[model samples]
Target: MTRKVDYLFLRKGSQNWHLKLQYPGDLGQKIGRKRIEKSLGTPDRAQAEILALPYIQEHKMHLLHGHKDFRIVWKHRFEPGRQHVGPAGERIIATDRELIYLDPQGVITKRAPNGDHFIPVPPLLEQKAAVRREQLRRRGVRNSDDSIIDTYLKHANVTGYNEREARAVWSLYKELTNGKPLREATREDGRKIVQYFEDNGLKSATIQKKVGWLNAAINLAIGETKLSFNPFSAIVPKRTDSERRLPLSEADMKLVRAGMEQLDRRDQLLLRFLATTGARLSEAFEIESELMERGCRYVIIGRKTPQSHRRVPLPAAVLPFLPRQIDGQQFQGTARSASKRLNRFLDDIGITDPRKVIHSLRHRAQDRLRAAGCPIDYRWALLGHEEKTVAEGYGLGFPVPALKRWIDKIGF
Candidate 1:
């Protein structure tokens, strides 16, 4: 079977996917419909999931407003173009461009300017839906755990949803419930889910994060109803597992420098770049060499933090490793490989704790700042960290010259 994403569902026999959504309010009474489902063509489960999401959304609009215009838009949206697999797994290519339409009497039409024909959707195609306003505004009081998840994800669709986090939540929820009604779900169910994660050898802190997201989702879905309780209310994910890798000792730093010498010129400079400037491995790998300059005191970090995109002063150790200017990226190869190479060197130098990875250099840089009497606020700002204090967010919290001195102290 194919992977399901929200409203997208895969057909067991046909191997095709569909979207299913619940219609809202008394609007269903007017249309003899309480739900909507649409076939998202393709035996390829991945593409169907992609196409179904937007279709479910449009279908939701039709369900809510029940307008002929919306129906018309939905009907012709999937123009029979290009190629798709036939019902029996045969290769079916569009002979010509054709559009599917739905007439008022629930008839489906396939219109081609070349040859005119209208075909109704087969009974098997009647399968999927996507709910609109996954926003808690409408789905809040809905009873299902799925409703809570839907609402939370819909909200995240705007700000941003961490893909890893979303996957973790679904993996746990999928194993825990068969769309159990959220209001009926209890604290015990939540605890059971956490235990499931632990049984699978997941870390306590990671499971805690997943629980946190579920807790937030349940809170969002608790509208004006008889139920005022959240199932995930009692999930405690302590921060004991947090990674706070300290700076490498001065002796260890020298060992790392020596290890860099063992690498080729490109990787040598790249590791040095990360070590001294605290740039991410990917950032060092993506530097458009044209951006670098000779004798420049400061350089802008990559786009990972746009708000903190101000120039940061470079330490002297990193300066010797620079080339006058090249075309792009100091290093070659994938970021993963680069990290593996760095780790191998760490292992060689007798430093191989799971927590003390390549990023510990960045931590050490911060320690360098503190040892040099740099303020905590300035230390983070220099590292292009999201300034923790509101004061940092307000304005140019620290002037360039002052910040320059702190970064200058981050030397080998």
Candidate 2:
């Protein structure tokens, strides 16, 4: 006698077992089929039952998730028959009887002719099936352990300090969200991030900047990811007044000037140049001596900002202090090291305020220009401040000679 197996049927002439399963009424319309069938491609019933488990699980998940294409190999097959209801309220008119059915708890059970049934899955196999179900359910869903920050950085081609800052902020975001995928990050997570910064004593402006970077990055990647909108977009902390660099007093200025001669020639020249012209420390370091040797009275300040990209006129007082000729970059070390050295010099000269660093000299230059009765346009142009009014943006700005006239009023 041939043994009967759940979810497996043998045709009249063939000894090979075939798999068949009936879809519940609701799922049949969605999958566009009332039943699913496929060849197990084996003569042995044991091998066929083993192969049938995947199909059975796939059908269960497909019905559970309402996915139409859970298993590609099993195609839909419908056969004509008169409708009849079985004892358990299952349709009995299908071409093949479904011996396997999902119980109330969703466990697969084998149904016998005498109304007896038992779950076919052992505990170990059931655990693995649960994992497989999760994998199938999450297909095409992003956030399943993928690094969204790395993907965004790769696509955006972010590099340098910007890349480093974004990565740093992203790391913090992960920590705040308990290392959740950035795509899975929610508005609540953004709130938590802001709260974290505030609790750590970060100023509102700094918190805003860090959050803004994260917001802008996610905004750029919204089109590629499944996220509807950036969670950090409206979560920015309120803006607050930023710290200002204190301008040097006349006595402070005089002290710096008198102390310049006590330093090395390079230090004296760097200090005098910044004090007179109000050029940024980085911009000053970028001034190639070769460009000045060609008799260019102005130095280009391109690396800072579009407004700072203007040519700053060399003040007449500092002209005697400039190197006549040198190869490559004018300053030896990086701009950061140069600022540290200049700040130390200020501290040594008794101008020791936290805000009275090397950058304060730039503020002093504007004050000096204002004292000399330089017009507002000339002051804005000389200090590389962005044009505020429509009229200010109209011209090529004050001529180099015109800028030199006002800048000359300030002495080292």
Question: Which model scores highest in lDDT?
Answer: 2
lDDT of 2 by residue, 252-363 (tens): 9889878886678787778888889888887887777433323447776645555666667788887786666534566667777788888988888899887788999888
lDDT of each: 0.63, 0.71
Candidate 1: worst-modelled 10 consecutive residues by lDDT: 127-136
Q: For model 2, name the residue pairs that clash.
A: none
RMSD of each: 16.5, 21.6
Residue clash pairs of candidate 1: 19-128, 19-129, 20-128, 20-129, 21-129, 37-128, 110-118, 143-182
Candidate 2 Cα outliers beyond 4 Å, as residue runs = 1-160, 191-201, 223-226, 239-241, 261-265, 289-296, 325-327, 387-395
- The TM-scores, one per candidate, come to 0.50, 0.55
